[model samples]
Target: MVNFKGIGEIIKILNMNYSKKNYAIDVSGRGKATPPPLQHLLDPINKIVHSQRCATVTLPCILKAPLPKNYKVRWSKVEPAEYMEVVILITNGAHHKTYGPLGSRVRLRHSHRYDASLTISNVALEDEGRYRCQLINGLEDESLTLVLELDGVVFPYQTNYGRYKFNYFEAKQACQRQDSRLATYGQLYKAWTEGLDWCNAGWVMEGTVHYPIINSREPCGGRLLLPGVRSYGAKNKSKDRFDAFCFSSAVKGRVYFIRGHLNFKEAIQACQKDRATIAKVGQLYAAWKFSKLDHCDGGWLEDGSVRYPIITPRTGCGGLPDPGVRSFGFPSKLRKKYGVYCFSVK
Candidate 1:
């Protein structure tokens, strides 16, 4: 029986009425008998268990990679197994925060083999950065650090229906359709600083409106002003409609251009026929930036834009002297005739 001396602390009482051979506990002043060793259930020392399979790390450990759905990263074990609880900590360049399933985006497995592990789902640009798991053992705190890197590209995105047609949620969904997500402010700024020039404003991850400007002409911001990213901060997320600025990690895949002049539907079908999906604008950008791929002919990217990337500046390519990604804006899906780019994951 437990004596209710106070509410904060629990006092266990053994049942004197029970036989010597039979182990029983009096659970509370109610006079009810329960199993033996009830004291261990509330024992602070018994709360945490050490992993038997893996050796504990002497120093902090790190695991870094781009993770897709259903992928898991194993965590390291902590020394001095005298802690009350284990906590997983995540830190970006800006701040440090704890991770839990209740309020945070990350979920802790609480399982340990060789070591402990943390698992995450629906990983976004905001989710990438640094992480560490801490053991809050009695009288001592220990931790191991990890760095997660996502290798992907960032670009602007808009719905096929039209420009400024998506709300914040819809914008994210549209990016997902293109194998991407609404770009974070940092990501959009990175793209802009890297010379991603677009005339149209788009919805970024923070529900704000922005656009990258480079060599700002009258149509953009202005040739007179120093080229930079323009912004419309903190608009109504639910009511406002806009395009999306998206970011995508590099996939383990190959991107190639399909042959023949085909309309949008036909272009998509050609890729499907070859067991590939039509490449997204960000994927195209990634291919160009990372692979140095150059094609003389402008082709259809996933966003319905006919564009081509030129790595080596030469004559006869779009009749442009500069080496860059040239765009043909969003064209009519039924009437536009152009080749399409396709991506296949290995």
Candidate 2:
């Protein structure tokens, strides 16, 4: 009986030792079950994060985050409903302005990551606040803030359209103010094709007529063309009737002008006396520019030709000699005659 009892005791001790060993193994398993080290788990998904807001009073918040090859960064505002007015989407980088409606959300694809930066354009005044960039990996997320302020003015290219009228002198002044001069022929051609005329006459620097003088050998001879005049002449045939000389910047080859109230022959003599001649259409076109044409009651052309006319020396008169009417147009033959004018440029 004693031997049997001792054997039973030994068996009981072995069972207890086995149970303790099992418990230790189970505990070790539970303790070791701790997730892989955070760094090792994050290695494949780790990313650098950054964000920014424009310094301008009206601009959108800009957010940036480093992402894996296929990972994407999502953006959202953490503000309340009333504060939602501050969110905007950027479109164009050149202008650096926000353009979309406020509170509008946009999704950026993973393909757009360049140096881990994403830009929003045309931010508004209310968009001048905090912003968050939410980096999404698996189910985890991280965010950053960008502050913005409004500071600079947005300038666009000139695009105003309307009919503007001004005299030659006034036009020049206007061009100077606008940091541009009268439109050149090429500009006029473009404007015309683009249908910008709107029935307004454009100004060509070539429209001003400077009276010239005849050479000394000519019948109506004068030394120093136009008599000691260093520049072309501005002659007023009558009160309030002033004629000036204009040139075309586009065509540096020649000059042109409109003649007012004169016969063809007298116009020729007048131009000869000044060492200038009547303007031709080609010359007119070469020197033409775009400008607002004014509608005036009445104006005269040399030789009474509403259309431009040619000027040449007076040669033959059928029967009359020394007639005061020395021009070759119907008006010149009439009892009432007007003087001829021409233009010239250096």
Top TM-score model: 1
**Candidate 1 TM-score to native:** 0.59
lDDT of 1 by residue, 1-346 (tens): 1123432222111122133325433222224434334210121222222211011212123322221223233222211111112234433322345534312544444333222345554444434433434332332233333444455566776665668898888888888777667777777787777668888889886678998887778987778867778898878888998888887765556788887879889989999999999987767776776677798777887778888888887887767655677777778888656888898877
lDDT of 2 at 132: 41
Where model 1 places Cα greater than 4 Å from the true spot, the runs are: 1-132, 138-151, 221-225, 319-322
Look at candidate 2 and tell me the lDDT of residue 231: 27
Q: Could you tell me which 10 consecutive residues in candidate 2 have the lowest summed lDDT?
A: 151-160
- Report the lDDT tens digits of candidate 2 across residue range 255-323: 433334554555566667778765432233233232111111121233243222222213443233211
What lDDT score goes with residue 55 in model 1?
A: 19
| Number of backbone-clashing residue pairs for each candidate, in the order shown | 10, 39
Best by lDDT: 1
Model 2, global lDDT: 0.31
